[model samples]
Target: MTDDDRGTRRGEIGPTERLAMNRTGSFDWDLDTGTIDVDEAGLLVFGMGAGAFDGRPATLVQALAPEDRADLDAVIRHAIITGQTSYTAHFRVDMEDGTPQWTHVQARILRKPDGMAHRIVGIVRDTTAEVTHSDFVLELERRREVQTSIVERTTHALSRAVTVDDVTAALTGPGGLARLGADGLALGLVENGSLNLIALSGESLEILDDFRSRRLDRGLPLAEAVLSGRPRFVPAFPALGRDFPELAPYVARMRFRAACYLPLVAQARSLGGMALFYRGRTAFSADERNLALGLAAIVAQSLQRALLFDEERALATGLQETMLPRRIPEITGGEIAVRYHAAWSGRQVGGDWYDVIPLPRGRVGIVVGDVQGHDTHAAAIMGQLRIALRAYAGEGHAPSTVLARASRFLAELDTNRFATCTYAQVDLSGGTVRAVRAGHLDPLIRHTDGRVGRPKLRGGLPLGLATVFGEEEFPETRLDLVPGETLVLHTDGLVEQPGADIEAGLAALADAVRTGPPQAEALADHLSERLWERWGAEDDVALLVLRRSPDPGTPRAPRIHQYIHQADPQGLSDARAAVGQALRDWDMDDLADDAELLTGELLVNVLLHTEGGAVLTLEVLPEPVRRVRLSVQDRSSAWPRRRTPGEAATSGRGLLLLDALSSRWGVEPRGEGKAVWCEIGPVPTPAGAPST
Candidate 1:
């Protein structure tokens, strides 16, 4: 080869020069000796001069910041301890020119026979551009996630807001600010061309109350946004204070660095405005401002929906009240109390209703009913049916005729709706209640005493259903209410509970009634508080309590009454306990057992053989007899006779129990019923008690 060709070959670049030109460097670290050897490229990557490095690990480490140096040491130690074959790390080195240069490192760990690291061969490269790009991408992703979370959670929460108050509570309640990703929040509504602040969320943001009600002037950023339907962002507190001096005090107390005000615009009009303040951020990026605007749009939609719901609900409630009776008439011989509750779902309007109408000759007709559904149509049908039913009863029709005609009336409307009702014609002068049931719950009678009973009245199908089924016969049940007795008529909502048997609800109602005050208004209130409120008032309820005027009889002739339901397990025991207590009070304690036993026997006979229930009355005979008389009355007219049964027979033992326990027992005819009577006392009076 010629001299020129050989010179050109020697000047050609090798692989080592190529790697150095790519900013890649190499190092040989003798781990055992704690010494390192670095190439020129590595020294350049570390921002160290040849004179500054002395072939030791500290020489290169000195070029790194203290935190980066510690981090690199930790990476090496962790790799050796975990028996790794290689290690990788990224860090920043301080350069001679006082600028930070990002560097990436890769090393190969070589171990001895005992598995201790002997040497590390590694490479270093300047990674400034790559790391900067990666960091930018990561930050963008973080912002996107935060903005997405704010929109998603806020939308889900506002979806269930049914009223304006609900929307307000959702935004200001616990965890609201944190979920909204704001250090502080302010909300205001547009009312009468002015902004009325309704919500302020933060630890000390209530200090902003001075500008709570302000005009749409540019002096306040939020008001200005609402006026123009635009958003304003203040990236620093200085700008905030300079723009609105009134907000300076609150901004100081809020300890916020940045803020954004957004207008809540829906369909070309502003409904409200919202303000978000940040303690950590000093500048608002375009992405951040756009996120605030999107949140404001979501809030605007929720507010619009809630306003519409409130408007429609008010209209429906007004319609419901207008259809009901203007005022309940005062009956001559009784005091009446009524209660009504609307459900909490949607609009709070339903088909439940109650009415009281005055009839001929001191008779009052009371009705409690429920149309089929909960919408406005059902309520409309209920109004028409109530008026028609009242007309029939006021015309002096029988209770049965009133309900039957009402059924036909409902069916003639030709709507796909049915109604269940219990109607009663109460003759207060004679203390008589004639009631008819149309696929509704039976009426309950609370005795002069504390015991409560339900009478089994036969019922036809529901109103429209009865007519559709070609049968409209509603049987009447005749019940004689003694003076001071309370008759209760209520819709099913009063005693209905979710996921539970209807029987359990009825038992609870009876217990609440039995232990409650005897006054009509007080009893109705008690039932409402105990049952309806406890059940969440998920359905509409209508309740009526009518208390016959008290007849304070002669003191010596005081009396007690109780009704025993056939389906009640506690009925027999309750009746027994009541009778025994009465006998003790009348100074006839010696006959308590016999009186209790006879009372149970007669009640059992009526309950077992009859389809309905029975009423037990215990009276102290006035004057010289000094005897307690007990009578058990039921709707069945078949007189109970003597029955001979074998020892093993369980049947016909009720009459035998009565025969064995009573002093003298006889059956007498009552109003469409039969009464069994027995006497218990004439006992030696209590030692020091006066005999009447």
Candidate 2:
């Protein structure tokens, strides 16, 4: 070809020849001559020898394999007619040795001055190795992507496993073992230094269940795997019976031939081991082993977290139960019913508590309070605050003062949390209730006529808020509980559901109170069940119901009465026996020891000081408030007085001892003698005004 015909081509001028010479091979085509010229390397790519054939377009076309010749010719013809700048083709070529390999040809069309194709310059190379290597890399990349997906799904599924059953389900269920290329799984946990099977799945499940309640000894393969904190694999697991004859029975039932035992270890602690099984012999690959180890680790972490959460939840529930009052005391004029519901989803214990403290003068102090959080911290704070409120109320503080003291108590702890509380004192005899609020929901009042409404009460800031800013004031709201009226006190959890309007919850609560059963116990149960069904508690709920009891037709005598003769030391013993019996009759055996001691002291005082006979009386008053009153009436008019006796002096310390043992004591003038009476109970305010 002439230099003008080949070198003057526009698209394939500079660097084309140099590039082709160094890497592939170059070819020059003269459209006018209708022939092509191939370099030495280009001839090798096409399996041709020098001068073996003329470089005609038809001859070059014959070199391409049959399947590629037509398409390559079509492109060359299009390039010549349209003046296309570049064209590329990949096809198979036959070598002289009868071997087939892939070849790639890239060519540029050289246009003449009139925009017509003058010549073609091209580069050619055998790309069989590159294509094969690219396909291999693509396969490896796809497999890696699949493995990553499996890991992500395994972790995601295990994340919500809160129990052994949940973990087992995630492991062998649809996407778990199958995705990980396993057919079955067994999970064994270390309990009391022994490996115990707690969960099993898949076709090999029966083999694991055979030892479900039994501990695997050190000789067992599973136990050894966990103890060593290493992975173990068996291509034919059924053959294990030959080494350990004791496992022959379980091996006979196993459906899987291959198995892998991976330790479930976290933070250097071996919590358990996971067993993966396959129906056919599996020579475990590195990727398979790695996936098993990773899955085991994830399972260990999830299981450990769930177990700790359950432990904490159980502890919190126990504490809450222990902190709550065991039973509601039967008051003289009213009955108290209480219900406590913890959140169903989380910690199971929350910061809601209710208490009924019997005040002086036949009055009952009712309290409902809620701390800020739903965790153990909040429950602990609730406990402390509940006890403090009870102590303050028992000291005979008014509703307002009691709450004020409680607020200060919580604020002083510096826990950075707040509480809302309501404290109410119900005088059953007077049918009056005085209540004070500390940023708490209003109390619901149900009238005797079946009408219910929330009582409007002025409230101060929540407990810790005022202390952070300044002093706080609690306002009181007083109302009379008519004959059949009942008061409902509760934490906000009862009336405030998640994302619902507070007013709506309040109205619903009021409606439930009005339409529920009339009796305190039944009404309390009804409201609890209904409210919980309507709106599951996301927080803790504390509900207290106090209702006036119907008047009894006749008055009942004191629980115990006795007459003691002069010079009768047996009277003291008899008095103690009576107190014990009375306490037992009240189902209060827990108080027998204290009651007996106090009764003995009073009777001894009567026997030591008085010469004449005395009347002993023990009575439990459940109206207006609940209290156990013991009185000693003697013919002697001498009244008993409290005195600070010397430590060594025992004779003059009876009254002093009585004053310390009893909640309150006084001397009263009777028709024929003087009566010394003392009260022991949750009876209101030991420091406030005495009973009228």
Candidate 3:
């Protein structure tokens, strides 16, 4: 043939010759005639000599594999139908040896003037090598994606763990085996040179029970991995009978086909090892081995972190407990219960404390307080504050004086933290509470009748802050207990509900107390369960419940008592109702009006002139006179004197009215306070009252 007919310039290589050298050929397809014209090189891709191959399109279709036949034909049909400029398809052709060869067909559609396709023209190449290389690259990418996904999932699951048990549960809990793509798994933790199998998942791994605890020096594959800080992959694990005869019996009955043991190493130190078993896998590829190692690394990191966290928490909480009261001092005349809790959230150490101190004359000092933080520093400060406050109260200081000294003491500490506290001097015999606050919540009183009240105590700033603000004066509030009443004092942590109003927390606390059991210890537990347990408290809590001994009177001398606060306008009316009821209960309704009048007069006198509340007690004297004694006691030391005032004075009539309504009246000096008492009697008394 001439050089131009051979597709070449006069002096250069021909196009068809160059295409043949590159293993590429050209083709033309006629849509109307269903005919194909392939060059010699293209005939070679069809595995046939040009003389042996016909130019019919059916000839190429018959050569393609059954599954690829329709695809190759549909490529051109779709291009023509959709008006596409070109189309390319990769399909497998059946070679003479019955092997499949990947073929690439790329062609441009030629349309008539009206856009109806009539022909196609394209070059052909034998792309087996290219397609095989591309497949290898895609498989590599898929394996990489799988390995990365395994690592990400393992890391994500272990991130939330903060303890050794937490890490173990993450690795061996439900769905843990499936997440790791293992039919079974065994996890070990190194303890004192021995590996302890802390977790096991799936079946057929029960053989690991024999090695649940083995020394690192032991020749077992898992233990060796931990010692050497390497991985041991058993590709033909089922055939390990010759190498490990000890495992032969177990392997005979095992359901797994392959296994791998990976060392858990962190900071160049081996913490443990992990073993994964497969059901259908017979071997582990390099990529899979690396994936197993990566998972081990994640578990190692989490286990190490959790171990250190547990150690730190133990040390912290131990120190905290050491600083607290080892035991509460037993006291007579009343029962006292106290509870203390550390912050949850892994802190385990905080500044909350509760203390009971004995004072002179059968009185007890109770303190509940919280320092400003949730760590060792706050706990240290709390320790010092608690001891110092206890000493101050034990030395006969009043509640206000004790808290003021405590505030000053905390201000002098080495820390910059402040604290809030409530201190009270309780006298069970006198049924009195002289309480003071240093920026703490007011104490709650659960009365004998199951009603709860929050005493409105005056407060200064927090302990250290009080001195900083030049406000070290904590005013003491006097509260009357009336036998069988319970006094509750707690740190703010007990009532601090996140995102809720402090007032709402206080209301909930009141409701809990009103509904809880009446005993001191039971009520303390109830409050702890209701508030601290329910909240999973993020801050430390300290609670104290002190219930006075009951004073049930004899049948002949029935008595009733009530506390009246000057701020409680309703308390004044309630006090009057209680007194009348008591008198009637004693079958002396004849004296109810007079006893109530005396109670009102004396209670009004105390509420009006005193700085705090008063306690009123009415009891029948067992003497034959059938006399009813009414007494009003207040923390105020001022005794009432019978005073006469002008009719229009509108004041100073309390004592004068008490004198006119009662048979006799007197004033007695009590410890830290005074009592104004009166007696009401009857000449025409009922039944056994006066038999002559």
Q: Best candidate per TM-score, number? A: 1
Best by lDDT: 1
Tens digit of per-residue lDDT, candidate 1, span 326-425: 7888877689999887776657578888999998888899999999998889899999999999999989999888888898999899999999999988
What local lDDT does model 2 show for residue 223?
78
The models' CA-based lDDT, in order, is 0.83, 0.77, 0.81
Query: What digit string (tens of lDDT, one per residue) describes model 3 on residues 1-692?
Result: 87656545456777777878777888998888989898899887777788887798778657876667777767767778899989998877778888767777788998899999899999888888898899999999997887777777778788988789888888788767766888988888889988899998888677668878777664677887888877988888878666667667777787888889899999988888898989889988877987888888888889889989888877877888888899998888799999877665565588889899989988888888888888778888888898999999999987888888888898887568999988888887666678888888888888776768776677788998988889989887676666688899988888886787878778889999999999999998898888885553677788899998887665555678776778998998899989898767767788888777777777788888889998778766655665787888777777776667897888788777766788888876553477788887753455654342
Candidate 2, residue 674: lDDT: 63
Superposed Cα RMSD, model 3:
6.9
Which stretch of 10 consecutive residues in model 2 shows the poorest summed lDDT?
550-559
What residue runs in model 2 are displaced by over 4 Å at the alpha carbon? Answer: 1-82, 92-100, 108-124, 150-184, 197-207, 218-221, 235-258, 277-281, 327-351, 356-366, 371-419, 423-436, 443-455, 458-489, 492-692
The TM-score of candidate 1 is 0.74
- On residues 337-430, what C-alpha lDDT tens digit does candidate 2 reach at each position? 9998767554667888999887887788998888998777887888898889999999998888887888889999989899998888888865
Evaluated against the true structure, the overall lDDT of model 3 is 0.81
| TM-score of every candidate relative to the true structure | 0.74, 0.54, 0.74
Model 2, CA-based lDDT: 0.77
| Alpha-carbon deviation at 348 in model 2, angstroms | 12
RMSD of each: 7.1, 20.1, 6.9
